[model samples]
Target: MTRPRYGDLYFGLSDSRNEANQDRDSFLQTYVDLNGSTKRVVRGDKFLVLGPKGTGKSALAWYLQFAEPEGAHLALVRDASSLPLAEVPRLQTGQEPGPERTVVAWKFILLCNYLELLMRDQGCSINRNPEVVRVARLLRDFGFMGDASGRALLKFSTTTVTIPVPKLGTIYKRESSSALNIFNLIPYLEMWVAEAESAVRHILLIDGLDSIFLNDAKYDESLSSLVQAAYTLNQKLMENRATGSVVLLLRNDIFSRIALSLPDSQKMRDDLALELDWRVLSGKAGVGAPLMRLVNTKAGRALGVDNFEVLKYFPDSIEVGSRELGVRKIPTFQYLLNMTRHTPRDMLRLFEEIRRVEASGIFEESGDRLRQEVIHEGVLQYSTKYFVGAISNEFAGYAGGPERAAAALTALKAINKQSFDGDEFRESLASVASGIEVDHRDLLRLLFYAGAIGNSIGGYREKSYMQFYHRRDESEIYLQGNFMLHNALIHAWGLRRTLGNEPESQTGAIPLIDRGAARPRRRRRKWEERKK
Candidate 1:
């Protein structure tokens, strides 16, 4: 068996939807089912998938919508970014802008989508049912043949319609003077759904909510309402014995804000949410880990090999050293994984950089595997570009957010240390604090939430640990504890070791001490004590 050239290898697109769109076959084939997420979605056990950006939330959604073995399921993806969400709250029946009215609006839109699906899939059968036919005609008259805009759907809501109930021999009419609206159509839509005989289960996937995120009350209310509407609509489907469900893909931070405004947030999280956290365990960062397995699967498919070992295409170990622990060799996979925030997109970006480096031929390679220098260069490039860009994009929705984030990063870089106590961090940002709208503490929290920095919990004696916001969405950032910049951003920011003053190398190559070797050294006993 011959090995494939590095130039010929494919690491998949960083965007999940792009990969699905451009390479449908490969995308479906290489999708890693971490924690049986696809299965859970198929079973309607989970409807909400929450995670920080690049944690594969969208990947899981696209997989559910397009992966083969559809067996008894018809999945459709509706990207929320394409929908006019801002116009949704305006369509509220009441004068106030709140989630209640928006929830009703979302229900109407979702119901229209379901009706369109039924018309497309179970058209002949649904036409036989008077209620389903009436509902379909109502939606069709409003220009909802699928892919209708929010404004279009709003038109459907406000338009008065009279439907003749053939079975009851009476006309169900809405007076031109009355306030009858979309909410009134909900019961009829639910009736149609309950009565229609569709053999396959309908799964509606709502993704790309992050694309249209804005830091405002209305945006928050609209998003929160969408979640509530999905939950309520799904419950109605289940209660009415309709084999259908609605799944929402949301970023953890956005979901956190929505959760705060929601009264039953905990209950919804417990019953409806499936967090796509792929943080690998200390002992399990090897071949079997989800991130590594995903890479292996994609590499295998790209190379036309079955059961490809990731280490086969990369070095076994990389040299790492620190003052706390002498020079030691750590697994290359672990080293690479540490450079990421435990997300598949991070790994994919890293590999994509490696491929680019390989194609450039700037580093000498043995033609069998990626050289340590190549991987280091790839990490540097990925950190400086993709990682930092991702962090900037995370906070871009807020006012002065991008500038403030850049200023905060500059302050961190000026501090020139990997880890710092709260005061040092606060002091470092003081010079740039004037331009930033948020207080120093709020800025710290923003950095924490973006996965740029994390609290350093525990002490050396207890095996010091780092807790990132992405890993613990429910946990708060306590400024009382020490904080460490994420490894992925260390190179980009040119941070130094916590104990030393030396700046990080230009390639961002800091010798990280192996976690196992970072234990507190035991002091040698005195001679007298030994004699005793």
Candidate 2:
């Protein structure tokens, strides 16, 4: 019957992968299902999960593999970091070390995993079925029976082995002159899986692809092959009437590059991919939006309350002003959401920062609610620590990428203006472009794609024409048009609110959040009042 303290409520972890690994129960407890992504995966309707960083792709994979839904299923979640991805091209597939060879290698490896799982099921026993015995022997011989890493398993690919089939002769006769490798066992493995049928469905979820990505030709080919292999294997399962599926988690940028070269790129994009985008229409993410609902779910579960109202934990609203929209009152949640790219991790990190500020006693709380001052201070800290670091890490794969991004931020700070023309922007970067290898044009493109800056789409008199990359896909930076800094990076870079050389009326003015305002009286819902 009492409100919970801000320190006592859990906002969930910043890294979903770590949470899924370390504390799965807590991770599942706080998870919020935005769309029907979980159902689509379970029903084998979708296999590819693609999204930008911090969009909860890993979390969705974890939930699909770990959650206990009302169905017969066997799920295996593999972390790609543990697999020997670099050694994939070395495996013998009778082809050059390219995407084609990688596809064959991935198919063999995936079938091997599925066979191991199928053989271990209670329905399958070596004593009952001779095929199970042969499969078990093959797995044990290949070092897959015990705790073997992918590198260890790949070592056995070159070994000569003879697998015999019933009624038929030996498939791969071991001989010094002509010997068959692991690729030759794919068909037999497929038969073993198809023949050993059970009521339970098998699902394999692969995560951590982004962690191992290097943004090079080899990685691009390797990743593309995995995707192709997964699609083909899923189709085979469906055709054979086998209850099995394979799902891959990938970053949107990586997928975009690989999809360009794929023959069936359109089909992959239109039919199989599930994009984990959480961005809502402007001014529409108030109370029940996906990201907001995620916060409420975590708070409710942590505080042991049903239908918990997260807005009660902070001030009602904050006043923000811009040249387009003159001074107006905005909800505290919308104000905070404006500073994020509409990702669950971003919201969680913002709340975590606020909790840290509250714990430091910099701003006193009023009746179990955080003061507006604490929220403001939290946004400032979050921008500098998490936002800047995330941007640098996003571009970490390119040559001198992190340095170039950092230099761009410094240049913006030196410019000390919120908006600038193309000439001013180039001149500002010229001052800081001492050792950076990237040119001014490339730097501008990088900043635009990274969502650090955007292009103005309309004329001077039009309002709300500013668009960022994260918000719209068609938003491009033009050398002749104006450029506005993203709202999320303004505080972090400490830029002034001036157009070219003219300062606005409210330049350097901080939004007035009610720090000493009295907490509003709580109103009981209709059902609660009826119960009373």
Worst 10 residues of 1 by lDDT: 515-524
The CA lDDT of each predicted structure is 0.69, 0.67
- lDDT of the structure predicted as candidate 1: 0.69
Would you give me the overall lDDT of model 2?
A: 0.67
- Look at candidate 2 and give me any clashing residue pairs: none
Error of 1 at 457 (Å): 2.8
lDDT of 1 by residue, 1-532 (tens): 7766775678889898889999888888777777888888877888888876788888887887776354667778887877766667766443345667778778877877877766666532665766466656756666554676554746634444333343321124533333334656567676776566766776778887866545687688888888888888888777776767788888877777778877777888898888886654423445567777778778887766778876677777876556676666666766776677667888788888878887887877546877777877778899998988887776665667668777787777777778887788777787756555557787788777777887755534354445566534455677898877878777777665674432221112322222211221221124324656
Q: What does candidate 2's lDDT look like per residue over 354-436, in tens digits?
A: 77887787677656567767877888899988887776666655667767777877787777878887778677787887766
Candidate RMSDs in order = 6.7, 9.4
Candidate 1 stretches with Cα past 4 Å from truth are 68-72, 83-87, 94-99, 122-124, 129-148, 152-179, 212-217, 252-257, 260-264, 280-285, 320-328, 421-436, 459-464, 500-532
TM-score for every candidate vs. truth? Answer: 0.82, 0.80
